[model samples]
Target: MLIAHRKKRNLWPSEVYRVKFIDEAIITVQSGDGGRGCVSFRREKFIPRGGPDGGDGGKGGDVILEASSQKRTLYFFRYRKDFKAKNGAGGQGKRKAGKHGDDLVLEIPPGTVIGDADTGQVIKDLTKPGEKYIIAKGGRGGRGNARFKTSTNRAPRFAQPGESGEILKLKLELKLLADVGIIGLPNAGKSTLISAISSAHPKTGSYPFTTLVPNLGVVKTDWGEPFVVADIPGLIEGAHKGAGLGIRFLRHIERTRILIHLIDSSSIDPADPLMSYKTINKELEMYNKELAKKSQIVVLNKIDMPDAKKAVDIFQAFAKGIKIILISALTGEGIDNLKSKIVQSLDKLDKLDE
Candidate 1:
């Protein structure tokens, strides 16, 4: 029920992809095969009949996934679906052991969760910057015939063969890792607010679906404390049911600690401001009840309009008990006040977590 971003790639302001949460991806990984054992018999002039001498086989390679903070998308995995590792070498005579195989390393963005595609069980969650997880283990090497030679059997003939490596079909899904998520309907000034507060430049217009993907920014308050903010694409009615561009982006909001719901004050349906507010909340509840319960701040944007008072009155009457702030992203009016409230809210949330 999800819709892929249909906007032409060139139409996007930045060619750099801003994919935040990837719902599904399939990966086929193959470990290297174990090497074969050698077979030989010692025949010397001094010793009439010497014992058998067979070398052991080497182990197969492993496949690994490392969590990296540099990567932000799973798009790289889309093209290369197959992953393979090297095989170990066989052992030689004189009880020499075989060489072990090399391991293959894959780097993924932080907050990525790995799951088995077939079984649907959660394998690992990559939350830290440099966390490492082994997706598939390598095969064990075979024992040499010399190891089998004992007091009872001085001339062992056969050596054990190496075990085969593991093969897995895995799926990688990404969850948005930001501290805060900005949500609102199209043209509600979500992008403008982010641009005003941080350095992220998302395409802005009066049209809907201007943003097809999530955008991230680092906002530093006057106190010099920095917090990560994500601008998720707009959500419309029935977004939880996969009605608009919002359904594809709703998952990204799951990782955020707070939600800032923005509303356009200049909207014609003076009551449209509050309607937009309730519709987003309904969609959130439909998709995830816990997401709807998260801490939220209702923001009435573009307050520089002449009819701003009407929007504020309607929102205040309908959405009571919810903290609401009025601001103009263009003129930067009341931006500092908004920042203060956000900082205070974050401080409280952090303390509660502690």
Candidate 2:
């Protein structure tokens, strides 16, 4: 039921396309069946009553899923629900082996996790680019009559049948991979901050829940390394219980190593500036305890507003020990400082891992 809008520019004019962002899909995949073996005997003029000369059957095709960086969403799987590979060819009578069936390779986006549709068990996690996993294996080829040419059964007429292919009902789930994830409530200047630092141009509006889907952007700093960032949807109270869009998009940020907790300075109440901050943290903890324990950088956005300074003072007083960075995403204030801090944090994390 989630709708996403994409703008397409053709040769004539710019047109808007309504595309749905599908993160989960259920599909049925089937591999090819092996070919049958042949049954024949050689009858030549020079040689009388020759042995069996039938050829073996060809192998069936396999169903393979490959991960690629080009794909962003699972939109293609929405229309295509069933996939079937080509069947193998039958054996010949001239002792020639049959050709093997071609493999059906499906290209999917990185960070895709495949699982069993019925059991809900994870099959494989395709996180890196060019990662390949075999979802369904092909059947083995059948033996020919020539293979049965023993001492007693020299002219055996019977041939073995081909094996049946595997069929599976699979589920595909996509999670966006990024180094940092920006999370906050609606209208918290998350879209603005990402636009100011990265090349991603997400749609920004004054209303809440403007970002229907997650947006990814590559942020390059002066340190000569670029990292990816994901802008997740806003979360509200009781989001873990499916109250708002949080339950739908919260999984997208689970893979991120760090998080930027953006809070709107203008919307914060002077009496309780820390209430909004605590609410978002509580939602994260309710959903996943490990996620709430990740490293976070608190940022107070929209500092250029009239009531922003008063709210910032109240929040600073409440969060005395915690480090809070104040920035105006609209006017590019303290943006460079934020970027530098992010790079420094990432470097420190890498060193710690080593």
Candidate 3:
């Protein structure tokens, strides 16, 4: 006896990747078509003649996008390029209207922005959960012959045709939302600091780009109020011009309430640290000046190194009035002080709202 073999499909990776913001994805959305109207006459043995009894047709389904806080990435729709809704049912005789088509609901990550492929103008920015936006409206149903029956025209020969469904080429972009964003070059100890403060475990390595996807950590201050922090991927030179992974993840920092720029003090050339800082700032200004205007904090990492001791002093002298801190993520040096300062800043912002 011959046995049929069952094939196993590779499951999608649950492991998150540190994705840059500049990638482009195309999605084709089609609304359901309206059902056709039915033309039928009602006749009974008792009643010889009955007025026009054709029922009206049902409306087509619509395409809707809903924001979900639980979803952190748009990877769900990455493979599925096509999205469609169900069509409405047709009408029947004796003034019975057909059922309307079911609406298609798409759950997307918070901070998702929808835009038209042609114009590139943003349609909706989904900032809050449960927020919904209609990208494509369903077509209207056609009227039946019964609707056309009037005093002047008693008998209508034909019924109106259904309207055409809407078709749109759409694009969705996701930007992470957090109270604070940590940015720096790869291996700058961003992952270490986040791991020290929160439960999020971002991949850490001696090599570059160990943390592929943005990592969110919940930092609870002394008062026990928790705030969110996001670690953006490493950005290299020419990131504003789409060089490397720089362009892909810059937008993720756009919605941050505050920016914490981490710098590595232990480097081959001491001046290279400051230069990297300036390069990242320049790239931020080039991409969006408003990003440069957001609140900023400068941190010098790997201060436990003997060579980094004097470098921190020199860096502080050049930092001028900007708030700067020396921290050793591996040793947990100055981690509490940094957390306190972050809480102070967040507290001030909250008080302002009150």
Q: Which ten residues in a row have the lowest lDDT in candidate 1?
A: 1-10
lDDT of 2 by residue, 162-256 (tens): 78889999999975357789999989989888899986789899978777677777686787456678887789999999876756777878978
Per model, state how many residue pairs clash.
1, 0, 9
TM-score of every prediction relative to native: 0.54, 0.53, 0.52
lDDT (Cα, 0-100) at 61 in candidate 1: 88
Show the colliding residue pairs in model 3: 17-212, 17-213, 18-212, 18-213, 20-248, 20-249, 21-248, 21-249, 22-248
Look at candidate 3 and tell me the lDDT of residue 288.
Answer: 92
lDDT of residue 281 for candidate 3: 88
The residue ranges of model 2 lying beyond 4 angstroms of the native Cα positions read: 1-176
Clashing residue pairs for model 1: 269-272
Q: lDDT for every model?
A: 0.79, 0.83, 0.76
lDDT of 3 at 198: 70
